[model samples]
Target: MDLNDLHGIGAGWWSRILAGFHRDAGLEPTLLELGLILAVALAVSVPRASWRYFGLFVTMVHELGHAFAALTTGRLVKGIHLRFDQSGAMMSRGSGRAGAAWTGFWGYPVPAVVGCILVLAAFSGWSSLALSVSALLLLATLLFIRNAQGAVIAVGLALASSLLVWFAPAALLGHLTLALGIGLLVGSVRDWLNLLGVHTRRRHQLANSDAHILARRTGVPSALWLAGFAAVITACWVHAGMAVAAVAGFPA
Candidate 1:
């Protein structure tokens, strides 16, 4: 079967699954043009076994986002990572309530943004460059950062998010924004509590402890950063939408 045929079958299966979920939730899930995009991405990504390294790159992007956020807030980055079993790069910021909050709040959005970029690149026919850049980013992140779980989670999340965007651009993008925000909020709260010595159990430990380094001057407000992140995500959605439109020969 042609790639399109294969993708159509996959899309049909996914549609049924989504329809079931939507019915259960008393909501509607729009049919998206993600199948073709996914087919293209898969066709391009699967040929080379080395493409798996892109996973590492996704991890790096996640860590780099945390690192950048911490740095912007005047926090020191103790370490970072591009590779690990369960996490991504870890930043070690100094001790402070604001610093802790910022670190936690900045975690998930980075990977989400990276995933958006990857989707854009893939759809725009920059697959090779995307894969190469992703691999390099992952290698660098692993070399520099320390949070294994964050790196791993970030990569996994990015890939999953990209797939969602590819398959269901409209619904998935909004959902991703909300989900990412919730995750960041939860992470921040957990980190703040951990910093206060509220949770000492190893099982309850935050993932990016290494990413939080020495504390620095409190510069930008976490709220502002979050707002900016939201904007970036919106832009990403627009880009993805346009790409899909172009692929369909619709006016962008």
Candidate 2:
């Protein structure tokens, strides 16, 4: 056997993972590639079967939003619980009402926020660093996972990111990052629309919604909270849309 194999991730792998940070991933996608990215994004987000799995990832991101936001206000994030049914909760302690509201408001719009960041990374040629950071965050999230399913999801994502960072071509990662970011952006919209549907058609599930929970907790109107989510998501979408338009050579 080779000595490099004995060392596992040899020097070459490290170089691949770090190379994009030094050099650009290159502004390289054609219009057809942009369409392909959009199509892949829609494919994962639209079909019920695909959403069944992808939704869980989105839910994880949603819960992470709450977890990190709680941490932002000096609250202890006790744990995060995620389920296969695309539902999740973050348990935190020692937050006053303002802090509570601060954490509560982060869950819905954060995936979009992340999407924009990923898009910017790809465009800015830091896609490798983006994947590396994402992998680290996924592993870090495992520490907070309270359920077996959550642990499994976090581990899987972390492993996939790690593998991609090591083996996937750095240039291709830009395209991959664009695809993932747009897919997440689409997933964010899908989740918000589902939440809106919950309020409109299924009051039974209103208790499960962040908007309603915020309203009940703060006496503010749920519609306003919903609007807040909408506003953030729309802004991300528009920003991402312009980037996508540029990538596709279209007028923004």
Candidate 3:
């Protein structure tokens, strides 16, 4: 079959399957979404071994967010851990509510912005240079940011997407972007659900373990910080002129 025919079949199958699951378990739709994301991730990652480096870049971004939060609030970074398998930073400053909120909010966007730039460049026919530049930025960001979860995800996503564009056919880029967008939407929903008190064992564990650390350092409640981060992220989408309603899963 032709590419267009294949795409139509794939999309139709996915849509029907997702719709059925969405009507059944409600939670099953999320699993479907996750599966789609994993498919896309693998599609982009399986061509080469260098793609694993993207994971390291992601770890850096995640840790960098933590480090930035510490420094912005006048806290000192005691040490940085940039392990090939894991990445994070240690800081000595007490976290204030505003500082932590802003740090968390900005962490993901920074790397996402970089990714978008590289994607744009590659699409504009600057593939070689863009790939090289993006790789460098990813490595540098990973090295610099001490504790940035969002940054790590962003970098990893970018790296995977970049590699796909480099080695894969141009036809796949649109599909990859769609997959990434869906993944982000799922993530946004997951975050919102956590904020809404839907308790899972993992959620409870995270709350029990990290809650005190956050509370002791940043006098702000976690809910409020999450709200602030959501607000900032929403505002960013608004400024980008995309339909904020779509992002929020509301009618535009």
Q: What is candidate 3's lDDT per residue for 1-252, written digit by digit as tens?
A: 999999997575444323322111111123455466457645433333533454445445444555666677776666455555433444444556666544445443433333333333323344334433434445455444344553555456456634543455434433344343333333333334443452233555444323234544577666554555456445443442232223335455
Give the range where candidate 2 is weakest over 10 consecutive residues by summed lDDT: 18-27
lDDT score for residue 2 of model 1: 100
TM-score sort, best first: 2, 3, 1
Once superposed on the true structure, which residue ranges of model 3 sit more than 4 Å away at CA?
A: 1-64, 67-101, 104-134, 141-162, 170-175, 191-214, 233-252
Local distance difference test, per candidate?
Answer: 0.46, 0.85, 0.44
Q: What is the lDDT, from 0 to 100, of the residue 88 in candidate 2?
A: 92
Candidate 1 vs candidate 3: the TM-score winner is 3
lDDT of 1: 0.46
Of 1 and 3, the candidate ahead on lDDT is: 1
* Per-model tally of clashing residue pairs: 39, 0, 14
The most accurate candidate by lDDT is 2
Better of 2 and 3 by lDDT: 2
Q: Give the Cα RMSD of candidate 3.
A: 14.2
Per-model TM-score on C-alpha atoms: 0.41, 0.91, 0.43
Which candidate model has the greater TM-score, 2 or 3? 2
Ranking by lDDT: 2, 1, 3
